[model samples]
Target: MNILLENIKILAENENISISKLEKEIGSSQAVLSRAIAKNTDIQAKWVLKIAEKYPQYSCDWLLKKEGPMLREMTKNTDIYGLLEDGVENFKILTTSQKQIIESLQKVIFYLEKQDETGRQEKNKNN
Candidate 1:
């Protein structure tokens, strides 16, 4: 099997999705990836790009070159706001309603955090 196909298989397995599902997500015709893997042929570059675009959490460099972590690294210091912003920015394929839901969820999280902080402060004062 080709190394690229092997890596793609690994990626699909790790994601817990079948090759058919991956083909649908990346807009490839049915059995496209499967046929390539079976025949030991190379896939088109556009398919790779589409896969990368559809799944931004995976490292594109690693997908192509296998040179880095399979998953993109998140900084330890990143806050919720940073994650939300990154999600909105990087996930261009997300539907408008999905983005709106993310925004709504962020608001809820902020409210909850504020409530928790207030409770902690009250407890500190009572101590």
Candidate 2:
């Protein structure tokens, strides 16, 4: 069986929701996940991130790698240091994909800023 699809099914079942409902909750198109699951194919990373964001209780690591418990244990007494550590870990996990996006956005911003500067210089010249 496909592990990612199976994990999604498990999470939906645990949440007492249908696959359709889970897809809707994660802002996925209808039958998008169902088709992937049916075909035993991989899901989009965006959907995975959406699922992780929408349902924090379910472990993303488990969904991706079947590594840990499906449901992450909540700790009421989590310290600031623990939170920071978790944040760093999450950042590291996202860095590879997110860094690409960030670089692309930065390039776009740089281009736009240069265009704006050029426009200002032309305006000044005309003035």
Candidate 3:
């Protein structure tokens, strides 16, 4: 998934809001939002501002960085993961086992995402 889309998904899941609802709240069309998420088109500053306004809890920096805290506030001694403070060569030195572990974690995350989507749909149905 595109980074922007991942950010959008994170915000949606965190706020318990549907993509459609979020698009509407941000004054953007579903097609525009979908394209932006897919990385097929660029998102304008206005769209970002709208989202920031609607979700004041999100940090713009965190939204753009995989290593940053999802929430703006950080507790002491928090070991943030996926942070890249070094060069690409450093990342390339990871062992095969490390790569496998990361892949496995990604799969697990995808599974949880599917469950979250199901729950959200069910909740919407109930309402």
Candidate 4:
């Protein structure tokens, strides 16, 4: 089976939907998907991107390269530390003052969140 077709089938199966239904959801026609898959031709990047754009649950790596799981593993939380790590990774392009400002903002945000939590706890206790 064509990898693109395989991924599309997998996506459709996972979503409890049909290929035609998936096509409708993505604003594509039946002829487009069937024609490409029937010929085993290379599918267009836009088609793959459309699936990824419409359904972010599908793994692009799996769809494009057959390298990963069909569905993307969902992150359990919005990891602030990982975001800070990403900022550090891009720190080379930042100026000293820019870095200082980001650090200050992070601290401010942290402090405000802590204060909010404490206030909530106090209110709950009073109630």
Q: Which candidate is the best by TM-score?
A: 2
Alpha-carbon local distance difference test for all models: 0.68, 0.70, 0.60, 0.62
- Return the candidate ranking by TM-score, descending: 2, 1, 4, 3
Q: 79-121, model 1: which lDDT tens digit per residue?
A: 3455466676434433443454355345434544665688789
In candidate 3, residue 65 scores what lDDT? Answer: 44
Q: Summarize candidate 2's per-residue lDDT along 1-127 as a digit string, tens digits.
A: 6676898988999999999999999998999899998888766666766786677666666776577787766453233345556777555545543454455345434544665688789999999
| Global fold similarity of model 3 (TM-score) | 0.50
Q: Give me the runs in candidate 2 sitting further than 4 Å from their true place.
A: 76-127
lDDT winner: 2
66, model 2: CA deviation in Å? 1.3
Distance from true location, Cα of 114 in model 1, Å: 53
Give candidate 2's error at residue 113 in angstroms.
Answer: 31
Clash pairs for candidate 1: none
How do all models score by TM-score? Answer: 0.58, 0.58, 0.50, 0.54
Measured on C-alpha atoms, candidate 3 has an lDDT of 0.60
Model 4 ranges off by over 4 Å: 76-127
Clash number for candidate 2 = 0
